[model samples]
Target: MSINPTESCLDCGTPLELTIAGQKKKPCPKCGAYRRKREYQ
Candidate 1:
């Protein structure tokens, strides 16, 4: 099986493969790390 690194948590390095529940925007399940917005070109 292949794991997507982008789906991992940034803070505690936990797996964040699941999407936020109903757009509630919950924190990481393992480390409780919140998601941050990023800017791209």
Candidate 2:
């Protein structure tokens, strides 16, 4: 299954974008990191 690099967050509905690391990141740069962390755990 392929992923959309420009999609929104499934949980918070925040728009997403590609990061320098090639990961889909949240629209809110600050909350993005926290959200990803919470998602993994």
Candidate 3:
């Protein structure tokens, strides 16, 4: 399959590396860390 283009992270504006994983609603590292921090608060 062709490598698909990645989308931007909604929270952090980082380019989501979805090229390898395909279209998944995964957050970027910074957003993930921020979300985790918020969840524990």
Candidate 4:
């Protein structure tokens, strides 16, 4: 099974529901700017 994680945008703090098999990062919906994913170590 795959574990999907929740990530937030660094600039806008928007909640991102990400899939494990999806891209490492995506653009913020609010700002339309690219945002990095928060690492869960």
Q: Give the candidate number with the greatest lDDT.
A: 4
RMSD (Å) of each candidate, 1 decimal = 6.3, 6.7, 11.0, 4.0
Identify the runs in model 1 with alpha carbons over 4 angstroms from their true place. Answer: 1-6, 20-22, 36-41
What are the per-residue Cα lDDT tens digits for candidate 2 across 1-41? 65435544555656555355765443554354334312211
Whole-model lDDT for model 1 versus the true structure?
Answer: 0.60
After superposition, the stretches of candidate 4 with alpha carbons farther than 4 Å from their true spots are 1-4, 19-25, 39-41
Model 3 superposed RMSD (Cα): 11.0
lDDT of 4 by residue, 1-41 (tens): 66545677778888776645655555788987676466563
lDDT string, candidate 1, 11-31, tens digits: 876656555548766688887
For all predicted structures, in order, the TM-scores are 0.44, 0.30, 0.38, 0.50
Candidate 4, clashing residue pairs?
none
Task: Indicate whether candidate 1 or candidate 4 has the larger TM-score.
Answer: 4
lDDT of each: 0.60, 0.46, 0.46, 0.67
* TM-score of predicted structure 3: 0.38
